[model samples]
Target: MKNIFKFWKKYSFVLLIAFITLSLFDLRFALAAVICMAAPVFSAVFKGRFWCGNLCPRGNFYDNVVAKFSRKKKVPEFLKSYLFRVLVLVLMMTVFILGIKQNWGDLYGIGLVFYRMIVITTIIGIVMSFVYNHRTWCHFCPMGTISSLVSKSRKNKHVLNVSADCVSCKICERQCSLGIIPYEYKGELLNHADCIQCGKCAVVCPKNAIGYKST
Candidate 1:
């Protein structure tokens, strides 16, 4: 089970590749992006953004592939500001719903809408990754924001707790892809809305200070 999870973490980016490539020949493959879109929100009901950290194909692509080219700088402040994120969420959702309605039952046309969405967003995300952190796009991604919102109502969602053994070395800060500094969260039940529950911080904590918990 562990190895299977590892394999998935390592190779799930291929789904992104296949979707972009094969869809050129058969746009019906564009529907596959729905899996990418819906999976994160569904999982967020139980574990905030867990799918973004572990299973999102585009996220995997950014971490595994785009990271190699990224400057790895801190994401810009305005991009992560509450108003900005909300605006992005509203705009993207509005556009997506309008497109879906416009195309309605025309399979080919709807597929084109999805195709355009994926290609354009992927291109923009890739460009942003090069200019900033690999996960820069994730800071305000519509799907990611929705997942975080969904997790807010779940009382028993997963979180990372800092144990008394913690030495506050701050090493976990470096491992987080979206700048979620785990060591900085001092509470016994720390569930930062943006935290993706990747457990990378827990793995690297020399003091064995961090563990999964629930609020």
Candidate 2:
């Protein structure tokens, strides 16, 4: 299971690119797109934004394509705020709903809507890649926002946690693509609303202090 997840984390982008390429000629891609889009909802219920961390094509795109050329600037303070994150999510959903309504009841029209959404998102990813750290757009993604909310509401589950060995080195903070400061939450489950459960904190901890614990 661990190796399977590692493989997905490493090569999921290739799958994403292949799916996008196939979507150009096949309607089956639309169904795949729907499933991909809905995956976060289900995965979040069990594992926070694990889908974003491991399987999201958009995230994979940022990791593989944008990060290589990214300027890696610190993300703006406003973009990390809950208010701003929710607002961006609302705006994106509004646009999606309006687009669907405008093309109501036609399969081809719906497919075009999904296609255009992907194109626009790719453009946003390109622009964000040049301006900020890789996965900056993810900080404000609607699906991610929703997943985080669900994860926050759940309790008594195994979640990422920090231990007493933490020395406040801040290495985990730097490793976090979403800007969470794990060491700051030492001795407790790191349940920040934006935590995607990516496990980078665990991977980067020199003391080997961070891991999942029932909380």
Candidate 3:
């Protein structure tokens, strides 16, 4: 996991490129969404937020744009939860009820609109990060929200630090990009919904504590 950027791990980058390329065609974009929906299923089945933690450009964007700056002043947890959920609901309603069609004329038009949407989302998320945490956009991320719900419903359990070897260094907690406080969890399952399963915590654990499997 430490060599996360090695060969096969680069599939995340490929997925991002595929998403962008598919945005040129509405059918393809829809297909991409369907494929993305499968990400958490795979994560739950295998072990990780394989898409978001590793492949998601949006996640990386937040890490670079927000987390890099605000190490000391973490965003208040409640604001990221309730307030952000409200904003996401509003935005979702706007998009769903209004059906803002940005596709103008040709394939280029479609791609342009999709590109603009991505940029706007990135911009808003980055701005929100100044006031919130790295997951400011995650509050509104449709894909992530969907993934979280699905993974939960599926009961795809992951094996966290469930052994006696755990030294309680809290490295897992600190390395967790999902903002999970690992020491608090007592069950074999890592119940934190925000957990993306990027495997960073597992990789960084000095005691080799964390592991995952499908239930």
How far residue 35's Cα lies from its native spot in candidate 1, in Å, is: 1.5
What is the Å distance of residue 130 in model 3 from its true position? 4.0
Predicted candidate 2 versus true structure: per-residue lDDT over 117-192, tens digit per residue: 7767777877987988888888877788888788878742556889888999998988887878999888988877
Best by TM-score: 1
The 10-residue segment with the lowest total lDDT in model 1: 151-160
**lDDT: worst 10-residue window of model 2:** 27-36
lDDT of 3: 0.58
For residues 100-210, write the lDDT of model 1, one tens digit per residue: 999999877888889999898888889998888888888888888888788766743466787777778889898877887776766565577788877889999998788
For candidate 2, report its TM-score: 0.91
lDDT for model 1 = 0.83
Order the candidates by TM-score, highest first — what do you get? 1, 2, 3
Candidate 2 vs candidate 3: the TM-score winner is 2
Q: Please, what are the lDDT tens digits per residue for candidate 3 over residues 1-215?
A: 65776434443445445666676555336334444445655665444345666657567656554577644245457644746666675676466334335444454544454455565666776677766566666655666665665565665555344345566788877776557776565335665556776677778877666666322
lDDT of each: 0.83, 0.79, 0.58
Sort all candidates by lDDT, best to worst: 1, 2, 3
Report how far residue 202 has shifted in candidate 1, in Å: 1.5
List the candidates' TM-scores in order.
0.94, 0.91, 0.67
Task: Tally clashing residue pairs in candidate 2.
Answer: 0
